[model samples]
Target: MFYAILAYHVEEAVAALTPEEDAALMTDLLQINERLYRERTLGPAARLGATQDACTLRGPGAGMVIDGPFAETKEQLLGLYVVDCATRDAAIAIARDLRRVNPTAVYEIRPISLYLPGVPFPVTPS
Candidate 1:
């Protein structure tokens, strides 16, 4: 299975929904999530926090931990969702479907590579 990254910017790309609208959209998102979950094709999906909640951790001379928000940009990364799929096209279709249902938001879809020391990445090149 291949893993996909669904990144979106809510504040900029989407308008705030009314209470009723919020409920409806959430229901739709939930339904989509349910379908993916039932198929066993879903891996771990999550909605990320603000970039300010981000931290940079890297090993320089020893190790470095810096605190601060992500650099300013045109838009902020508001959330993310990871899913397991059979192909990039499948993942792309899912993202497109999501966009159609949530026209208020703009999202990007990309596959990820996890190169563990021993374990192979979940996805392989086509």
Candidate 2:
């Protein structure tokens, strides 16, 4: 089964990280990602851009485009990871590994009901 791990974190808290601090965190996270890749369980993963750069289209039909996520929450969705695991516990274990490296971030794991493999594209590291 495939699970989607949604990462959430306070925008301000994440933004406060120094370049070195951020790089160290990413390095640790990537190490785990590399391991998952070798295991052939890792799928598409992405770190979303800032909410300020996001737009929301709500209402019926075409809908109106609104600026920002506009969600009333302290922590915003930061990134996500998709992994193929044998069981829910296995998926949770993967999230635990991510939490070990990023203690401040929150991960919500959900089983994927339907998955569509879209066009493949090269992902440039940030």
Candidate 3:
């Protein structure tokens, strides 16, 4: 089974991190990512851009294009990780590992119902 680990964090809190602090956090995260990659369980993982640069399209037809994100929650969806796991417990364990490094952030784990691996794109690791 494949799981989607949605990472959420308060935008203000994340934006408040100093460059050094943010780099340190990314280093910790990359350590775990490296492990996953070695284990061949890692899939598509991405750290999304800030919501201030996001836009939304709603309603019928072409819909109304609006600036900003779709939600007004305290914590915005900051990033995501897709991993192959045998069970939900295993997925939760991965989330726990991530939480250990990012204690203030929230990780929502959900099984992927369907996945289509389209054309792959070269991604430079952050």
Candidate 4:
């Protein structure tokens, strides 16, 4: 099974870190990513740009493009990792290790349901 791990952290906390501390943290994350790649379980992973750079589009097709942060929450989504694992337990283990390095962050692990090319997804109206 494939799992997507969404990482969230308080932007202020991150901004408060010393330059050395921030560099060290980034190094640790790089090591973790390298290990994941070596284990062959890693798929896509990336740290997003600052929330200020984000834009939200709502209502209908093409929608109304709104330029600004999407939410008023203190914590913002930092990044995500997609991993192929044998079970949910295995995925949780990976998340635990990641949390050890990034102690202040919260992670949400969810299984991925991939659709084949040209396959249609069934949508039910609320």
Candidate 5:
């Protein structure tokens, strides 16, 4: 099964950290990412730009394009990963590992479902 892991963190909280603390956090992140890549558990992953750089489109007809993100939340979504795991428990384990490095970070794990006209969905993990 494929799971999407959403990672969230408060921008201000991160900005308040000292340069050394930030470097340590980044090093921890790189180590975790490297391990995941080596294990082939990490699929597509990327850090998103700040919410201020995001824009939203809404309204009738063609829809109005507006500045800012779609949601207003204390913690912004900082990054995500598409991990292929055997079960939900396995996915949770990955999240737990991330928590060890970034205790303040929040994660949301959700299964990925795909549909095709003729392709059959497999019962096993990919």
Candidate 6:
């Protein structure tokens, strides 16, 4: 089995989620999390705040925590999901379902490279 990360992001959804929508989304997340828990494979990952809320490091031994980031870019990272699946398609399936929440919401689905002891990687044909 391999691991993958489903990075969820939104542009202006911050504090934009309606009370009902928020509750619904939370319920969906809980259901998914519970399924993953039962499977004992997939799992719920951490939810990181926006870059603006990040404690950024400027220079050596220098850093600061701010309310907003300097960069003015669209699509802010909302949250993420970690999964242990047999294939990328499986992970993509999960990511695809999340699209139901907000069709415009972006998700970066990337695999978590695994390097197990004594397991050799594939060799390319020269």
lDDT of candidate 5 over 1-126, digit per residue (tens):
889899999977887899999899989988988898899888877778778888888899999899987656789888888888899999999998888999999999999896222455465552
lDDT of 2 by residue, 31-83 (tens): 99999999999999998899889999999998999998876767899899999
Per residue, candidate 3 scores C-alpha lDDT tens digits across 22-105 of 999999999999999999988989999999999988999989999999776789999999999999999999999999999999
Using all chains and alpha carbons, the TM-scores for the candidates as numbered come to 0.68, 0.91, 0.91, 0.83, 0.81, 0.66
Q: How many angstroms is residue 72 displaced in model 2 relative to the true structure, after the best TM-score fit?
A: 3.9
lDDT of 2 at 32: 96
lDDT, candidate 4, 60-84, per-residue tens: 9879989877656668987899998
Q: Which candidate is the best by TM-score?
A: 2
Q: What is the full ranking by TM-score, best candidate first?
A: 2, 3, 4, 5, 1, 6
Of models 4 and 6, which has the larger lDDT?
4
- lDDT over C-alpha atoms for residue 38 of model 2: 100
What lDDT does candidate 3 reach at residue 28? 99
Candidate 1 lDDT, tens digit per residue, 1-126? Answer: 556655555453344567787688778877888987897766666666556668877777868888855546566565666777779888887777777777756677776787222444575454
Off by over 4 Å in 4: 115-126
lDDT of 6: 0.66
Question: Which sequence of candidate numbers ranks them by lDDT, best first?
Answer: 3, 2, 4, 5, 1, 6
Misplaced by over 4 Å in model 6 are 57-73, 114-126
- Prediction 1 global C-alpha lDDT: 0.67
> Which regions in candidate 1 have their CA more than 4 angstroms from the true location?
12-15, 115-126
Q: Tell me the TM-score of model 3.
A: 0.91
Candidate 1 displacement at residue 36 in angstroms: 1.0
Q: What's the residue-level lDDT of 105 in candidate 6?
A: 68
lDDT of 3 at 9: 95
Q: Indicate whether candidate 2 or candidate 4 has the larger lDDT.
A: 2
